[model samples]
Target: MVLLHQLDFSYMFVAIILKQMTPEKVITITRFSVALSFCWPLPMTSSRNQIFGYKVAQMFSIVNVNLLLLPCFYAIYLRSDDIEIVAKCISQSICQIQSIAQTVTCFCKHDTLQRIVDELWTCIREAERYEKEIFRIYIARCGRFYGAYVAVAYTMTILYLWGPLFLPIMHVVYAEYPFDVNRTSMTAVVRAHQIIVSHQCCAHLCVCVFGAFLIWFTAARFECLGVEIQRCTDIRMLAVCIEKQLRLRRYAQDVISCFRFMILFVIMTCSLVMTLCAILIITKTSLLVEFMFLLVAFFFLLYLYMYAWPADHMKDMSLSVSRSVYELKWYDETVRMQKDLLNVLVCQSPLKLSINFLVPELSLRYYCTYVSNALSMCTALRAILDKTVA
Candidate 1:
């Protein structure tokens, strides 16, 4: 009973701390991400001194991910004969791969990202009062989602980081080292290293948050464009709307180009992780490990969902620009205005979020298909596992 009380107290304390730390007043997602830049060496700044520091931090982050990968690979090799251990190690490896992919992509696309940030900030500044309100609403919505995501992610990290303290035989990561982790000194060293890498992983995951918010921000602009088009009272207003639409299309394309590769890698890896976890859940004997895999599988699905939801919405909103124009009282307008409206409709199509020739359009529909395929794969694996076991 006393132990239970202590656990409850710990939970309450963490909840309090997290609430206090949450960025409740952040009016712009870009601003919030700039704060993350200080921690993770993201290309959110142009200052020479800061760029030097960011390069150093970026190098350290890459080295840290590599170090984590070494032990994970070695552990997989040492435990190759054990299917369960191998499965666990592979899952960890996938996570590091995700971190490394995002890290390297960010590093390579530094100048491009800076331009995107600059353009996004300019959009924010040029927003009208109503448009600014739209942005604020979406920013708050995203902030709440991000706060919950971080809370859950960090809570899980803390549990795994300190798992060895509670479970005598469990280590933070299921990897083997040349030096015995059973030794107090070695254990401390390994735990410290794991703890640092785990936080670095958290930082990498924030890249997802940034991407998600950008999608939302773009969608919000499309919505604003829809409003502006619907309120067009003259051909002059319509011309301005047409020009804005062109600029927005180019901006959305830039946003998609910047992150498409990372998205592709995430989708592929997350799909594999989900399939493996599903199969492992059915075959694993340890209830704790099975539950862990179940959580992991669910998180991976959510990870895909985070992108799919915004991508789908943004596409819809962008395509709706034509509809918004159609709904305008254009029948009473001059012939020239009518011809221009037709031109707009002819040029407008859904701003698709996809990797050309790599995957289908990323949307809610795509997410459902991905989930369905994963389930199918899991079922086939289950049948094979059953046959092999029998």
Candidate 2:
């Protein structure tokens, strides 16, 4: 009865929190992101206690990731001869490491992140009805995509955690701990920890969604700027438009700068994981395991494409800002206004998001190239394996 009351209280507490978080009928991506990032150290709190709490959560998150990661490393060392098991452990470890990297990046750069969010919110508040409507449309679309991603990720986590119960496995995750998991108490504790860590891992993956949403936000702003340019009828309006265009350009660069390393890391890790998944699919005989690998590969590709598509759209929308200047009636304006417009055109270059200035611009073309390269690598790996077997 005591345990039942505690459970009821927990449920009620969760309900109250959710109620407070979503007072509005419609929940925007920003609000949903806030909820998803409850454990993340986003610079949202003002009180010292809240800041300390976030730090504590951040510490716990890092510890959880390492706890899972160390066990996977140990499992890899223990089962070096089993290719299938090693592949699974490596895949899981890579994900946890990625989570850790993302957490560290967010924690280190929360100030810049907060500034970007403030800029976005300022634009939203200052925007006209049409501009707000434009943002709303993009926000709605992103909210749906983010919602779907969280659903799929959490569903996979649930399946992964519960699979051992209905299968031949002894533990939830394929990890080796120093202690004996054969013992009931130890096993239960380890399994619960694994489940909690897996959920945390899923939450960390929402960083990808947050990044994509920022890109979409930039694109929508560019589209709004285009509209603003079209309405320019005088030097003052044109000046305002030009100022906004420059601001948007700076904003886009800031977004790229903040996420550049993350993009590079993701591309590198996803490429390797895709290749690993391909190898596993070829070597693993179990249909279930093969399907899981296939899903992982597909989702990674999809995540990459998510960034690529928006980045490409943002580039096009950015260029269209300068083009919108052409639609303005500059012929009737004075020579000085015409000269200023010409200068604006000359300065308007295409904005592209690259990975730390190393990779090419992120676009559908880049995404396609990555997919093709991943496939080629998979083919090469398969050939080598076949040759060895022969």
Candidate 3:
């Protein structure tokens, strides 16, 4: 009971966040996100459908991470003079955009996405059967922490946009590039443009948030599976729970494995994101704004570990289930009971929940490797960019 309450209280903040980050809610948000990104992060159009269309948005998400996409976008953002400096900045942004779009691909297929989310919900429901309060605590805590992390990161990003509105100094957000608004003196028109930008930014952030939530949900599922183990009674009925646990485990794996593309995308673009951050920070003009950007980059790494840590824990728990077999009163049980015990003991092998167990166990060691690799790549890319600048 004490453990129950501790788990319950620990997830207090998480509960608040989960209420808002449901799968249904995410789908609705994705619609706005799709609309905004294609229309250049603008919500509604000056005339509508001028730039935003079904083909345009669909084509962009599908091909945004293509090899040539980054270079093409960099070219578009280019100016006549200071090509070298602008080129570096554009390269960094390209890395960030491409990395993000890779995750977006996971949501492109509604049917696949629906199945994945259903599996997630099913795991949660199954876990609830054993310990309702404990599951609630873990899910809520996971939800809350991720929710808070995104909120802080988005606030910093938005402030970077809205800072000049409040500050005494009237520096344009990107004065160096100097984009001028070609608008008539219409207040409603200007407000509409602002709304578009706001929606576009929100959608971009939502993609990242959704990715984070997916990992958090997996962790919560593992918590449920682990908790069930401790509460597991060695009885004739134990066989039934074992079947349910296996089914739940498979479902969790299916959900995670479905997003293999997202993971691969992150891996491919991670080096660039790290490189971009490192280069910018070293040559950052504004300390405060760049720091916030750094925080945003850091959260990507945080999200990676959130997925890995629970997977590692789940691996330990699954293996530990077999150890329980050693302590059972197998001698006193009848033939059927002993047989069932034997079956479970054999089934509960050391399970490493990863992408087919090919990836390293999602633990601190793995996370350190991820960080180090990204940093190393960043070093190389920064060196190349530095020589280009010189």
Candidate 4:
């Protein structure tokens, strides 16, 4: 029994160690994959093509203002506490309202309860108004970062679609030292280098062609609301402003939907491409399967963040905003819905504070404590499974 206990404990320790190691390995591999993805050039070679590509890239960059970069960079650079503040605000509002509701529910007399509920409703309305006003400012600030983000997205998409075609040529020209076939003779090496350089030049030409197409497509399809906002001056323009705002919102929603679909397609395509590449590499060389798996894992992680997570978040936010907008039936109704939605959008304010601070933490703590109490549940299940198997 003592020996069996020791073996069980050892196995458990190993499992814990492995689990911790897995997250660290995943982080490392993901970093490398992101670097490689960003570094790889598309096929665009000729001077004319390069100029065209630059022009195309510049079009996207024009609207991709410093505003978009700021929030995203801040999010990346900010401490965990800052992120936690945003998350806490989101979850806490619901809890605080529920708590208020519970307190209001305690009154048994109908007349008194009605009076209390009225006061509570007034308080809720006032709080929501303040929250919305504050959130608008925050979102306006966040919009600055949106432009930079779009530029990055545009560049990444261009690279992903056309990068594979240039990989073989890139491999030939920039082959790592000790792997160069013509390394023994300087003349041979120079000739091989020239050929590889010419291939890269040709690849860049293709990049320019596709890049120009994307830029023109995006510029023609998506107009910047910021540009319109700058041009508005007349009072009668308010009607025009309203129409423009609605149009912009609809365009944003459509773009988000399209992006989500594009990401899904890319992830599926990349998965297949990576699988094929791995198979070819394994067949051609004696590289370890474990290393190949790690490489694939890295690519998947990059895809998960750059494609999957962003698409999912955008879809969720778009749906939420659309629903809130749809709920507006009258001027008063619109104001109220706007207030609630704004509270949800803003990373700060009490409405958000009450939900995050009072709800998820409580639930999470309860879950953790309960799981600890039932620590042997897994073991018991394992025993049952073993018996069933026997």
Better of 2 and 3 by lDDT: 2
TM-score of every model versus the real structure: 0.85, 0.85, 0.63, 0.28
Across 56-153, the per-residue lDDT of candidate 2 in tens digits comes to: 67767888789989999999999999776876787788778877777777666666776787786667667788887787666555555555565556
Error of 3 at 37 (Å): 9.3
Clashes of each: 0, 0, 4, 23
How accurate locally is residue 109 in candidate 2, as Cα lDDT from 0 to 100? 67
Model-by-model lDDT, in order? Answer: 0.74, 0.74, 0.52, 0.33
Better of 2 and 4 by TM-score: 2
lDDT of 3: 0.52
Q: How far is candidate 3 from the true structure (C-alpha RMSD, Å)?
A: 9.2
Query: Which regions of candidate 2 are displaced past 4 Å?
Result: 1-49, 139-143, 162-170, 281-285, 384-390
- lDDT, model 1, position 268: 80
Greater TM-score among 2 and 3 belongs to: 2
